[model samples]
Target chain A: MCNERQEQDPGKFRDQIRQGKWQKSTSGACPGYVQANLVILPREFALDFTIFCLRNPQPCPIIEILDPGNPIVQEAAPDADIRTDIPKYCIFKDSKLVEERTEITNLWRDDLVTYLIGCSYTFEEALVRGGVPVKNYLQQKDPGVYISSVMCRSAGVFWGPMVVTMRPIPGHLVARTVQITSRFPKAHGAPVHIGNGEPIGITHLEKVDFGEPPVIDRGDVPVFWGCGVTPQLAAMKSKVPFMITHKPCHMFITDIKIEEMAIS
Target chain B: MCNERQEQDPGKFRDQIRQGKWQKSTSGACPGYVQANLVILPREFALDFTIFCLRNPQPCPIIEILDPGNPIVQEAAPDADIRTDIPKYCIFKDSKLVEERTEITNLWRDDLVTYLIGCSYTFEEALVRGGVPVKNYLQQKDPGVYISSVMCRSAGVFWGPMVVTMRPIPGHLVARTVQITSRFPKAHGAPVHIGNGEPIGITHLEKVDFGEPPVIDRGDVPVFWGCGVTPQLAAMKSKVPFMITHKPCHMFITDIKIEEMAIS
Candidate 1:
């Protein structure tokens, strides 16, 4: 099933996910298309969260924001429905994980505002294309995710520490890696920290908050980029009455091409 | 006085403006610093206005947003007060211009939120530095401003046509002009419509809605950039009960250097 998903058109692929025919992570699906992290909140909490994303763009780059009660993603994927297109959805009530479901049609409300944030997958692809090898991609595994000591600029009730994803890059290629990823600011842009992570409060690179342990070889520097998880953490910490997001790695694929997001 | 203003530090220049000693346009004042557009609104209208700016970044690039009830611009100018920093401000009521003043201290409210948006002066400096001539600068006059037929992507109650500032660039340097200005996305980035103004609803190059008439030579083409006036136009058209903005060409100078806003 995973093998068949590769190279499929975005719209057709969304149909497959919507119909419950595919339920795996969307990592390698539609290679050249953009995949986004989902965050749906009620209209009451929309303003602060939107401001939070605007202030902390490194961790929360908004690709498209759906109008209140609007289920269609007009900018990213015009024909797709937000409630049913993703492979999986997580419901949070009062900051606690309440349930994980395949479809959110039953829980959809008229005041819900959906935000599609850029995922690291886009920049990772750019890194590979630029001849800079990403260790986790080469190993076909998830990169290390950690809770850094750097606090995100707070917006209203949203306040929390920044979370970062780490990739092992060869020391010689760190500069080129930054240049390649910097083109796609929407996809978490440049590295927040490099070489030593201690300044950012990461004492142990081997012990990560999420994903597989990183493989850091000699002469390899652990490069860190702002992670999409920062917003989720902020949402949980803020204890908003209700919130919804895509299950980790189960992103919503958009019609936008990767090249279209490049700054140059 | 003009020579004294040039090369003067942002802090000192802001003090001069705060004391009502500098009532003229901010152009050429604090040459290397960033100048910003000011928008003040009550807390009730902040969310929608902010969302409008985020949705339409090219026209309304935000440099910093002060928290509700907080008048100090901590990010852009920490010691500066939003109510008194700019040389002049325009007051609007029910979408109509009611008054113009040097300070809003008497009208200040605890619920007001301030937004400092990027101004084109930063990019115009970049153009001059890059050897792309800006006709208005060469002529020692303000660039032409026009209300175009291009409609902005509406957010909530804010909706109106985009306003553009025109600069006649020599045909040979139009491409270079684009490359230079594109570096400052925070300050009205790339040209929205190039060469033909009629396609964007401009019938006469000699007539403009604001500022001086443009000077277009036979070999020069008119280039349009999304102007800061766009948000003000939207606010007026939306008929928001009350709003405040910097008077034309009288902008708030920030401590940030021009190079800081440039994208690599």
Candidate 2:
């Protein structure tokens, strides 16, 4: 899957996905461009969820928000359409995954508001550029994700524990990794925990909850970052009647470059 | 008033103001602690205003937001009360300044939600420490403020132009000043415009719109930062029926250290 077609232009890549010619995970789809987590909710619940993102920015850094009933992503990618850009979409009804579809034109609602959230891929690129070897990138696999006991600050009807993604780094590069990733606050920023994940309620590194189990070398330490999947977990836990999110590992590519989101 | 009393503990400093012994502006009070701009709005408009802050983070960096009908500032300072902690309060009716009082205890309502926004004093401190001499600091006066033509992203019913505060810095240290201030994104972050104010519609730096007029030295260049007063300007311009804000320069001091809010 890591072929020449993956490195093509972001808009052209979205075009392939939109045309249903490509429907796989977007892990290595478009390098250098930003990939975001998508969450669409009815206007009645949009305000509380927007506040939820503001309250817990680490897990859910917003890239851009579209006006109600608008399918065009104006800020992140003006030419992209949210309804069919992503390779796959998850439709949740009464907190249960009811169906998965290639396009959500049938489920689109006039009262729905879309939120584009920053993903860990942005910071992962920074870590790699900073000479920190990420185990997931090295193996060309998704990092392990776990639902931690750390509860996010509840906002309105949204209440749930935080979900985090884990990446093991060589012990010598832990500090440097923190410094490099800190520059992109919009993309999960710094590590929430380092050295051990016990305090966050992850007792077993081998027994994972989501994605593949991480490969930790002898001197490598497991690092955790607030995952973009957190808001989905929260929405599901709160029993939101209607919600839409990008399928796991399938993201919405944006025109924003990784450097543009960095603070320093 | 750079007296010993100014360096006292934040909680104790609030005690002085709460007891009526301190009634002056909170410029130098609790030096190392974070000072914030205050905005109290009814719960009906709370969600929109929160979204407004998230959208226009530069002009309105929210440090903490209290739950509706709650006066206790749990995150920034748990022991303080929003209704009477500040030295002064301005009451607005139909977006017009209707009354000024030392405390709003009598006008307190359960539906009000308080928002504590970041102030420029944090970044200014960093600038002073980084060898950048701010003219307003040397002259013991507040920086000049102006209503700029830069329009803020409107949220719901909130709509207005951005308000900016100007500090004259030595031409050689303009870049250094930006670097120092950029670390504190929560505190107005970096300069919006560097040299000429006319581009931002500020034709007269001498005839200031708010605060004291700045003193630009021979080799100094005027730098502008998004002012905390911006949200207030928006609220007033939108003609919000009811609002409560701290009197100009009378800020809410929090226990969080300035370094905690720095990005890198």
Candidate 3:
């Protein structure tokens, strides 16, 4: 089911996931296609959350926002059923994770509003293409994720510190990495902090709020970017009554190519 | 009350407008600061309208979306009142222009949501600075605005053809113009159509749906950009129950500088 031919097409790959035949991380599948971080919230919290993303665009660049109660994505993927397309999903009640599901067909509601946010994985592809070595991509492991001290602009009920992903880029290739990633603003776009993470509130390089620990080379510089997981952290801090999100690294693949999202 | 001293400071300039001492266009004022298009809607339509802007960011880039019923903008300008900050405003009822007013304080409602959309005026500043001739800026006339045949991605109750502002640029400067404007994504960055307008449904270049007739010169190319007036046109087409917008050429100025909005 995970043959090279099937993995090259987003539609076919999505089919395998929808049928519960594939459940691995979506990192290398559908190589050139876009992957999105999912956030499903009730209509009541939709407005504030949308404004929060708009205000803090770097960390939460919105890719596609579905109309309330509509699970069929229109723009990113014309007919993709968001409720069952992703390989995995986490259900949160009052900011606490209560369950994990392969599909949310039964949990879906008419009032749920889904947001497909730009994920760093999209830009990481560009980084790799630009000759910047992405250790996590090479190792096939999740990037180191952390909670930065940077407080995002609060929009109504949504307010919390920003969450970021850290990558160790070779010192000489740092400039090239920034240039390449800056092209995809819809993706996390350029690094938020380049050299030092301490100023942004990352105290210990070894500590990570999420994902695996970093594999840093001796001459590598720490590069930090706004993460899509920010909204989840904010929702948790706000203690949202109920929300659904994709499991980390198990992003929902979209029909859009990386080039379609690049600014230049 | 309009003086060089007051014009330089957005706060002072807003005060003069709030006091009804200034009643002219906002073009060329606050030279480097950002200016915004205003859109006020009821909470019933807030979610859908926001989604519409998110989907069509090139035309309706959102700079600031005030909290429902909260007239004071927080990020754009800390204490500026959305109700009275702009020089002029138009009140719309059932999609028809009901009244032109100096302020909407009398009509403020708790259920009302105010959206500060990015204005092309902000990018025009970059063009002029980059040596690109902005005829409208030099002649003190509004740019040619027209309704294109291209329809926007619909979001719930809002859907309409994209409205564009046409500018005549010398053929040689076309590439540079695109580069300069592309920097300010928040300000409807880059041209949607360049060279010929006929392809985008402009049958006659002189026939504009709104604003002043264009001043086209020989060896000039017609460049079209996504205009911020798009949302107002959509609101009217949808015949929303109530809405408020700044009068054409009048805009809400923010403290953010043009460089702050530039992507690179």
Candidate 4:
């Protein structure tokens, strides 16, 4: 119920949201824990989407995948229900946003498969700790997301352009930022492109596609990382019959500590 | 084909196998290229097997997964056919080894799905390059394999104990060995257990389960790594109706270089 208590325990934080006691974006809560983007699809399309994630790991680094129709997460957060843990959920039908709900307990079905994907929060924290400038982090808002010209490998029915989140890093820190962020491959790993937006088809950095235009400092270089919003675009472009995702900025907090994701 | 020729071109090596001019194990051939363990299954069991690999990446690090019934590998090796590229293939029926064939073109099915998993050879090369002693490299044979008590996270109809390959490292070099091998996550990453193997259910270091017994010198400590042979064990234990895998020591050589698998 309190900020201090939620920061200390991922379980307690989920319980607060599950019971409807707290319903807000989980951006800064549970600081050290891993936060994931949720994607729920029917078993019919699970294989294609799973393969899609496997092929496009930079954009879709999967943290944990629950069994079909199973809502309880065992690895990331033990006993956390995928249906009610997040503050908000977006229901998509025929490639369109059909509903927004706080909880989907009534909509849970046996054939629905839940996939917890790594988001940028984990690596962005590492970047900030590594002395890199993250303008969106300082402003406490989401970064600018763009649909790049790079197309993801098609798997069965899932295919779309990769979506990336841009962060302005000083020219001197671009290499260091890549080193820091590359440690967490599960959290969208390293930058897919750096400095030049023209090659990746971003003609204008300020002409935003999804989020607000980023604030680029005088001597900073723009670094782009694969974004979790990619699946949403894939879903819409493919016109999937039914799908569910966590609303923007509201993520599923897992019990895995950010340190556990770092490689040697 | 000469040894020097095969070492330079992975595509030429596969062409030799396709032409039946070479039918030997792929060990020490194509030094810098990546070699993968092959697993082919029916589409009915592909999802479960794919989930099994995703859940247990330490033992089953997948390098590339092909589209269902499509044998041409696009990412790992362009224009390479999975059926005839490998030197040998093992056919399993109801958990029993039914045949060992040079190619599976006759047995290829439209519903079959192929999974190319990371083998320890990639990391072993790095270890040798980093000045670590590798007994199997000197002996020109596969390392000792054991079935451990640690069970893999099961998915659907697939479940089995983890299989690990044992390497004897001198006490002074164990830490360095971990560091060197941990860089290549695609190649079974790092050692699962070091020093004594009793905790992981390996009582006798000499009693081998799958391969030749290792050579442990004085002051040497047994280090265990997740082996690619794990999927074969799972297939046998789960009594999968029909499955295909590359024979022991014989592997599918991919075009990806060893350095590409390294992480920061």
Clashes of 4: 0
DockQ top scorer: 3
In the range A82-164, model 2's lDDT, one tens digit per residue, is 99999999999999999999999888999998999999988887788789888787577899999999999887788888899
Best by lDDT: 3
Q: After superposition, which runs of candidate 1 have C-alpha atoms over 4 Å from their true positions? A: A5-7, B5-7
Report the lDDT tens digits of candidate 4 across residue range A145-236.
Answer: 89999999989889999999898899999999999988899999989999888898888888878877999889999999999999778877
Candidate 4 global lDDT: 0.89
lDDT by residue for model 1 (B181-232), tens: 8888899999999988998999897898998998888899899999999999
lDDT of 2 by residue, B1-264 (tens): 457655478998888888988888888777778899999998777766876787788889988887778788877998699988999999999999999888998788988888999999888777887898876765668999999999998877888899999998888898898888889889989888999999999999998999998877798888999999999998888788999999998989899899888888
Residue B146 lDDT in candidate 2? 96
Range of the 10 consecutive residues with the lowest summed lDDT in candidate 3 chain B: B1-10
Residue B156 of model 2, lDDT score: 70
Candidate 2 residue pairs in backbone clash: none
Docking class of 3: high
DockQ score for model 4: 0.70
The Cα local distance difference test for each model comes to: 0.89, 0.87, 0.91, 0.89
| Residue-level lDDT tens digits of model 3 in B1-264 | 224655678898899889998888888888899999999999999999999998898899988899999999998989999999999999999999999999999999999999999999888879989999989877877889999999999999999999999999999999999999988889999999998888899978888899888999999999999999899898888879999999988899899999988999
With a 3 Å backbone cut-off (N, CA, C), the pairs that clash in candidate 3 are none
**Candidate 1: residue A252 Cα off by (Å):** 1.3
